[model samples]
Target chain A: MYTDLVAALDIGGTKIAGALVDGHGRILVRAQRPTPARENGDTVMRAVEEVLAELTASPLWGRASGVGIGSAGPVDASAGTVSPVNVPGWRDFPLVARVRAAAGNLPVELIGDGVAITAAEHWQGAARGHDNALCMVVSTGVGGGLVLGGRLHPGPTGNAGHIGHISVDLDGDLCPCGSHGCVERIASGPNIARRALENGWRPGADGDTSAAAVAAAARAGDPVAVASFERAAQALAAGIAATATLVEIDIAVIGGGVGKAGDVLFEPLRKALSTYATLSFVRHLTVAPAQMGTDAGLVGAAAAALAKRTDAAAAGV
Target chain B: MYTDLVAALDIGGTKIAGALVDGHGRILVRAQRPTPARENGDTVMRAVEEVLAELTASPLWGRASGVGIGSAGPVDASAGTVSPVNVPGWRDFPLVARVRAAAGNLPVELIGDGVAITAAEHWQGAARGHDNALCMVVSTGVGGGLVLGGRLHPGPTGNAGHIGHISVDLDGDLCPCGSHGCVERIASGPNIARRALENGWRPGADGDTSAAAVAAAARAGDPVAVASFERAAQALAAGIAATATLVEIDIAVIGGGVGKAGDVLFEPLRKALSTYATLSFVRHLTVAPAQMGTDAGLVGAAAAALAKRTDAAAAGV
Candidate 1:
């Protein structure tokens, strides 16, 4: 089979997206459907099927050698299943098997959304050419993935870089994930907004209280808002430093809404990094903004699919 | 060149040890010397050379294919240099090149001591069958290494899993490494003893004030000593759990003096782990004592040499 393309799927709580991507990561056809997140598992699965149906109907589908899925985790690549926390209807859902069946028995590769984004970054964005890196998303929730020895390290369960859940403050606040002082609890967008509000940073006339609003306020010299962002930066710096110390990543690529805060996040992050990344090997680590846009998930899925196809070909599968 | 043995050197501040190791990880011949740690760099080099010379004089030296050194870090495997903190006399020393020349131009492999111990454990001890694990030493200072995908992850500079310096409490005590609230600052043997003494725990009739003595006091139900051990356990648990959460390790193998505290350490460690390792993938992580003893560094150095030799052979080098 001289297949030159792969089908990619990016499944999240809000949407099910599908695409036929070439070796160069160019999408030739696309499909998407709103996720019935609160509906039954079957309905959510049906939305995914509808998106896959559209992709299968495209002429580009003929060149797709395999199917790649980057889904909201926790995903079990070993079991080919996913049970994303936001999508309660899909507990231990057998996604890979269903996608494989829907794609005419094509081989399937699955990874967490964070891992998928890392794949995209490593393949074509900020992490490109870096042998070891950490790529993170700090929007509604903090999530991340890693590249080790120049390859994506999805780990045994496809969730290697769960930095958000790692405790940076052992005795701080409890996270919904059942851990205390998690990075997400301190650095995520919602948490940033919450902290700013708790510190008496009232919203503007429009009453916009998102982290973006906080960033604007910080830009306008609001001390309380600035302090909130600073705290979030400290937590993120601690987490990033911890990751580098553990695995020797030379760069951390930050993405998502909160990452878009620009200097409000990066300046404080760099300063705080010096406080935590003190080891000789880790002291030289750098942080950067992510380059890939919303299409990161699809492109990253394609990268993984291509890698899987190459591996299978090497094994003569 | 059908070599069946490799020469191994385990270099630290206190001692320099060498061995001729077989393919099965057995030490067939050995040599040792005290490190003149405070002397000039040449003196330290001389001690290492003496140990290597003894190994080279052994009858089994004829079968040695390469030389491997597991040295107190920070080691730069890429630069073939080392600058161990306790051995200040040898900064950026070209130990690998010297060892290679000393070993009759044989290939040389170098790794950090923590990584070396991890290799030993993964090859023959606590982490033997696990594909992913973290092996730690909580002695005078904390140190650790990782086994990922069933291989020792020595990382680019040969220092990957340096979990001791990771901050589990972002706003707590300042660490000598310049980081705040590092695991070593809270959980190391010296730190444990320091905390116990600072909290008003009196020394015994022998006036011993080591972490081992604190462990004994805790074992005998001394409240202050117990509290100190519990605190150390909490820090270790947070560090270990963070490692597991980030890298998906199924087990954490702890060694060194504090690890010998048995229930005094492991009991509270397991309890605190439940508080931090709350992610679905990390919830099942286990903790165990290292099976490899003082010779772990030697055996692990041998393991790296064997791996290097195998890679060379496979590449037709």
Candidate 2:
């Protein structure tokens, strides 16, 4: 069934991404442009329009029925607006209207970047076939979304999966949200590098070693690297396992940049899960890595569009 | 809306309960009998039957069209069987079929007792109007149910909400589930009393002061009692906060025997929540006492019958 394609956009701090996605979670035509960070919301929308125009061609665009944009944090999906904490210019901006204006307003859907990834995972990735699970992006700022009892929670303010803000340690570190000991305070990419630098494990700006490098070094038997990954994993896993005790999902899907630590992260993460979530049933909680890689946001946006179709069909009002 | 009344039964180790409930979440009649633990499953069923028979004299019984049961842990809600860890003679016993047979072919529905309470809370109590929440029983066991995105997760075996088993401290305590540091082992009623007695709080049967007594004494300003409650709250709040971070629910319904500590529990619970859940959003999670109280099981069971009716109507196939 040709349910019409959706132009999925991922608006990041550094990049503007747009993709034409069909109902089956496939990315057809894609466009990428640099994001103008310092510019106001209007300028940002202009850049988004340029990227969309390049993909639409006004011909292929006819085949697409709507637009879906996954933006950064503190979003209000219900209002179709965003108050991104990272992009200072985007305070209560009407991003969905702008994207709709750029794409000729077939229908516009917006979600937290985290929620988009969660939808992507549920639709056709590591979290497939699971109704209750957490889709977590452990990247620049840890965030997540939940598919609980087989439904997505857009939350009252669309901030349901803000995992990075959850504080595991009381006196550990401070986060951008003015919280102390948040997982993001100590486990985000920059935090990992800083921790490494503080411990004399990071080689420096010239080294430019990522969390992935720490994972590699940990694998190579580097004690400090091992310790860094373990510390971050400890915080992340504690939070995850604690959640398992309450929400009781069968699995957790990890994605985003920091998730690339792979086994270095998963192994220790599992160990931590076992340690923190010692419940009989919860001990069996499985941790899986996302399979969709970088295209998750786009695929997830398409899934959002598909969900709208399903909801509308279900209502039949 | 006179869909038919449901005879809902709850069989705990300490109590046997029966209630007649209509589709609108109203309990028309209620009765209780002490559980004869030394007797086998057959004897227990006879006791349950006796209680049900007592309730049948009520006017609502004539309208009762079905039965719903919520049994102790390790139950198979789908199969309507239970082998409660504390109750003997229940090894794979088909509680639903037996209860149905006793009820004379009444449509029988089965759910984890915890899930049953969760259903009740979601329908009429703390979790009402919330799409995602948890129903937790901090009584004889640390049992719970997940109402994620507004659906109850019975798991494959219907034993999904076993929150007490979630390990809060790896080196904390030994649980019957063979895992270390389960919240149950650390914070459940028995453990609370056990630890308090072990710590030389009150002179009595060690583990006998009861979680209730601890709450009372704590409320009355006993240092030992205060400490015990704090420890339990600390563990429980951490678990609750972690769960909020994962599911991002608006409320959690806490019920069962031990939840009566009231502010004694809620105060320390909040303190621990704010301490362990550093994330601003999760730290804002709400906790409420279960509204249905002891009848929550019956209420939830009747809700299940109501759900069955709604489903049958919707299908019309």
Candidate 3:
């Protein structure tokens, strides 16, 4: 089994990524193409096919036992379809069927990209060896997944651990998802920058008004910028504490652009967590920065494929 | 196995209730004793032993296979200890060992009272046959437990679903549990009655200031009383939505004293759920009243014992 491999795809609005990954999570071959996100569904799918063609052309392709796709969601793993918010051209797109066809009729597993990231972290990154954990990405959007009872809990629809959309402030600002005070509304990278600028923080000479710029200003002791990050941390802490209280997670791994704000974000988060996660079972919960890098999607896709393979074999499939 | 019974104990601050439950969840023998909650640890243990002795005196006790205890938590199932907040004298009490000895050394299983209710609900109540659900008791406190992937998720500590203490309002009133705006702080029966009284809703000539009194006043179109129940319903809805968002539970079964307030609570809760459970996967979540009655704890304890017995047999123990 160590000699065998799985073909993996990380499909997002910006790129179609393909790889042949070994059993130990090593990428033996890789291919990528920019997604034609604004075009029709068929056009975007062609880009995915081309990336798959490159992976299939590799000599290691023959050793691939299955294919796994981690896609921008809401993905219906049960229906083998995806309806990513950023990709308007592909609502209810039959991704698993198309990927299976492109990969020579091999078995295919589909999961939301956040769940994929969690799979990576649980297998080889910050959440490794922890039975109950949550791994999150706090970039343009906040997304996450859970590992429960020592296994990835993708739920019936493969979208269980969606912490960002969960309301922490029931009466706060209305979110685009039609919810009030969602964690993403307060803690995402764009929201952090927006809140900072709203409260009178100005960008540097470069005019770079991103969360990274806000992080730099916060480190420099800018009061308004510091306050913005503190608010985001507060919302994140509330959400994380809620998650721990609900499911008894021992650790929460945070990644993406805003998570890299270091102590500027973590300090206030730790303080706020103490205020919210007061339960006996949840008081010991810890927050850590995610260790998986940009390739987490591909690696996690491979892990999903491997798990599916094992499950099928156990069922005599 | 059908002829075998499990001895079940429902330990709380007010009472020590025991029963001999068969495989079909029918109680054949019963025993009860008032809890010596303020007495020393030995007195409380003695009360439990007396209850067990009563059950042992029944002729049916000869066919008992195991014993299960569902105690007010936080229960440490791994360590076989209980530290129920309402029962101070029994902090870290070795209930499992004591019960095992009292029950002729039969194998024992321990779970939190909330988890016990969830097992009963999943097995024979409103949440029956659901693969994933949350069962809650909203009486003096808002305790709850989860069923995930068709199995009771008691977590490692036997206290996975302590929903009462989860903060839904991050900056709201400080809770007695050292948290801010816990669900119990806002939605528990006492809190509901208190909020109504705080807002000038006077009790009747009967001087009954319970949540039930508020429910009656609200039913008679008292605006203040209606508003208080609405506020409690709002907090409960937020907590339930957060649970559904994090774990993908399709149904939330609510029981206990406050739950019996009927349309006064349920109407507002259903409306508020739409404001918080906004995600596609969570939008369809339903709230239903718990079907199991006062005996839920004993039956649920029996379910835990039966499950443990089956697991041990499967392991060839």
Top model number, DockQ: 1
Question: Candidate 1 lDDT (Cα, whole model)?
Answer: 0.94
lDDT tens digits by residue: candidate 3, A82-194: 98998899988998899899999999999899999999999899999999999999999999999999988888878888889887777789899988888999999999999
Q: Candidate 3 lDDT, tens digit per residue, B146-190?
A: 999989999988998888887777778989988888899999999
Name the weakest run of 10 consecutive residues (lDDT summed) in model 3 chain B.
Answer: B1-10
The root-mean-square deviation over C-alpha atoms between each candidate and the true structure, in angstroms, is: 1.5, 3.8, 1.6
Query: TM-score for all predictions?
Result: 0.99, 0.86, 0.97
* Consecutive 10-residue window with the lowest summed lDDT within model 1 chain A: A1-10
Q: Per-residue lDDT for B52-83 in model 1, tens only?
A: 99998988899898998999999999899999
Interface RMSD of each: 0.6, 4.0, 1.0
Clashes of each: 0, 5, 0
**Which fraction of the native contacts appears in each prediction?**
0.89, 0.28, 0.73
TM-score of 1: 0.99
TM-score for predicted model 2 compared with the true structure: 0.86
lDDT of 1 by residue, A89-146 (tens): 9999999998898999999999999999999999989999999999999999999999
What DockQ do you compute for every candidate structure?
Answer: 0.90, 0.31, 0.78
